[model samples]
Target chain A: EAGVAQSPRYKIIEKRQSVAFWCNPISGHATLYWYQQILGQGPKLLIQFQNNGVVDDSQLPKDRFSAERLKGVDSTLKIQPAKLEDSAVYLCASSLGPEAWETQYFGPGTRLLVL
Target chain B: AQSVSQHNHHVILSEAASLELGCNYSYGGTVNLFWYVQYPGQHLQLLLKYFSGDPLVKGIKGFEAEFIKSKFSFNLRKPSVQWSDTAEYFCAVFSNQGGKLIFGQGTELSVKP
Candidate 1:
């Protein structure tokens, strides 16, 4: 009954540096999501995965941001050449399914600060 | 293609006072609404959700929200607030199944005991 888990609760990197965030979903959860929450703003979904396959990533920045959910249990989000605007909290969430009504459980999130 | 707006960015009130936070979503078609709360240094948690049925949905921690179709608004309210209720609240919307959730900026509530 553990909740979603994330690594490196906080991170700091210089501009143009590469940063990676990791997430581990709840046990038996089938759907996973990554969101970016800027200060004073709500979390914006960056990508979503359904059992090792991407369900939606339209909002994800393809030019510099990429994510993968290999084996469908754990996922990683990477931002190459990070910018100042990329400083935000990276949140990972999981749900029982991809249905609209499913309740999503969220992790503590990784707060990234780009210098 | 959905957006949410929160009327208030920050609110402060004494304990036992009534609380209300306004939220509006822009979606013409059928939609689902949600209210999530995040305590200081904690992850976001569901306060309540609306997916048809009753317009007024009650959530945990004595929080409730009413969906007004005409106004396209879902405002969270509490009859009596407490010091423990201090947190940030977010409003989100989903227009389709498996779709990404669109969220508002967020409202930070501070309750002084």
Candidate 2:
């Protein structure tokens, strides 16, 4: 089966610029997540969606970061007025369900560079 | 306030050498453990996971992990690592109550032929 899909493997933008990353989860997967991974650090969950409703966004920087999984299949994450600290790889993952034990499959990720 | 910790930031090893990477988590309730690997230019892939019923879990590409609940640790191991094993390994923890997955700072493994 095909894994999760992400667009624009890389992006370079200056601070205060806006950038958006897209993700398409695996077919039939009901749980989708967005994570940020900085250099030398592990991935951190930014948001999670179960179908079209959000399951968690407590870690997301709501002032700059916003994500939506409309129609319950494809999702998009946008960073407005991006900051240097936002330079990281944005990873999208999907699971069969929202259970804690379910395995999550990841995408290649969109690497963003903020100047 | 749950977190995961990986003991090593980087490791250099020769081919055929045994490998072990330490990971520990802090949580007060039942949790699930996972080991994910990302090769150069590739996405993160699941190496192994431990939910219950077994302490020793084997995964793809000759990798394995042992979940020791008492120590709050889940360490990855390989008997003889190959040059292809060079990659970044991340340990993560998930809690039903917390409703989130937490990852440790990854360990970069470099294998010499």
- Candidates' DockQ values? 0.85, 0.91
Cα lDDT for residue B3, model 1?
88
Score chain B of candidate 2 by TM-score: 0.98
Docking band of candidate 2: high
TM-score of each: 0.98, 0.98
lDDT of 2 by residue, A1-115 (tens): 9999999899999999999999999999999999999999999999999999999999999999999999999999999989999999999999999997788999999999999
Give Cα distance to truth, residue A53, candidate 1, Å.
0.5
Off by over 4 Å in 2: none
TM-score of chain A of 2: 0.98
Interface RMSD of 1: 0.7
* lDDT by candidate, in order shown: 0.94, 0.95
**Pairs in steric clash, model 2:** none
State how far residue A86 of model 1 sits from its true place (Å): 0.5
Model 1 CA deviation exceeding 4 Å by range: none
For all the models shown, what interface RMSD does each have? Answer: 0.7, 0.7
- Over the stretch B32-113, how does candidate 1's per-residue lDDT look in tens digits? 9999999998889999999989999999999999999999999999999999999999999988843768889999999999
